[model samples]
Target: MKPLFVTGSSPALRLTVALLLSLTLIFVDSRYRHLDFVRSTLSVAFYPIHYLAALPPRLARAVDGRLASEADLRERNSLLERENLELKSLMQTHQALQAENRRLRDLLGSSFKLRDRVMVAELLEVDLDPYRQQVLVDKGASSGIFVGQPVLDANAVMGQVIRTSPLTATVLLITDAAHSLPVQVNRNGLRTVASGSGLINRLTLLHLAKNADVRVGDLLVTSGLGGVFPPGYPVARITEVRDDPGSHFASVIAQPTARLDRSHEVLLVWTLPALSRAGELDERPLDAAPPAGMDTSR
Candidate 1:
């Protein structure tokens, strides 16, 4: 129904009315200071929506962290695998070089004078005897090893086989107190008994007369007189020659030519007669003189 003096509201008038309503609410909040309950009610009502809104971001962050961890693990594993492969290759190369060296030593061993064939063996360990220098090898009775067998390396005569078991054998190095060999000066063929000084690399030439022609730097070789070691094998080098007039004996010190502490391989000259008869011959009685009449004529 139309009435006299009626007015219609404009858009500006409607906006002004809404602004006034918002101002009245602000005034009421400031004056009462009690909006905590209202705010908590609104938060409880919209909690499910808030959780739903955060789901995508949390999922993205979790996925990113997992991917980073997986990548780091893969990189570490790959690096370790490569290092292992390189180490394996180095080990293979070392083994090949060792085998070649052994073959060469065997070929050169035939030049030495010995009755039995030579068997190439590896140096396993060195004994801790302070008075008697000794070494252990990988050859033993099972591999045709026996006592008194001469042991040599690529450079010179190393030692002699002293004892043997089924799989391991002990070698008496030339530098033991009990070890003595007939050696000759390579320069003048002067014969003398080279005795050990209880040191693995040192030896003493006994019975060297004051007028002997042995001097410093004279290389000593096996004289082949003892029937224990092969002939012409390098024994030692004269490092010192002391000719004291007061003492009738000349104090001479020599050094062995073999790389005793350095070599990883050695050769076992199968010259021990007891080893030849493994089961057929009775080694109990003949062990003393089995090879007595044997032609060690070299």
Candidate 2:
């Protein structure tokens, strides 16, 4: 008993109508781009929700990138700092080597100025007594060092060997109170005796004439009269000259030219008489006849 209200469209007609409408929409959107405005409107309305859903993953990526960059920067800085320290260390070593080279050069240059066969020795000790100016050296009797032998530094005369052992020698500086040497005025050839005053920086010219030609800045050299030191070597330089009516001689003060308190190396000078020139020469003629076993000509 079908009712008359069931007079709606048949199932096949309804299905065909829906399929045709879907096909028409797909064709219109692909060919005419007519849905662009509608799509944009829908995206605007849903944008906040889409962004909220993506926020956590985007924030995590940004934080990770920042941390990685900071770590790389810290490692680079550490590497740079290490390289800087190594460079500084190398610079210091180079400076030290340069200074040592300069010192050695100075020492060799000074050796040529010596007039005797010289042996180099290092200073080992200095006297602590304020009343005496003396130093000990490494060369001794074993090295042919003897008492009264002249001792010199790189610049000038410092002392003479006063005591000796098998392995060491004691030198009495020119500034010792008991020490004296014959020195002449390099400027005017005025010979005088300079005696030490126990002070390292002072010497007194004894028995100098009141009208002596010595001046305040005159240079004094060994006179070779005493036979202890070589002739013409630097001794001391005059620093003060004073004349008194009551005294028979003028008083003069001088300072030694050598770096007495600061020198590290010293020279022991030996002035051995040279062999005669004829003996030193090749006395045997090259053309002289050879023995029976040797041929005269090659």
Best by lDDT: 2
Q: What are the RMSD figures for all models against the true structure? A: 36.7, 44.3
User: Which regions of candidate 2 are displaced past 4 Å?
Assistant: 1-114, 126-128, 274-298
Best candidate, TM-score-wise?
Answer: 2
Per-residue lDDT of model 1, residues 237-282, tens digit only = 9999998777666879999999877776898875434233433332
* Segments of candidate 1 deviating more than 4 angstroms: 1-116, 271-298
TM-score of decoy 2: 0.53
lDDT of 2 by residue, 83-198 (tens): 99998999999889877877887888743232369999987643445677888676767788866778999889898886666666778888887677788999989898777788
Backbone N/Cα/C clashes per model: 0, 0
Whole-model lDDT per candidate:
0.72, 0.74
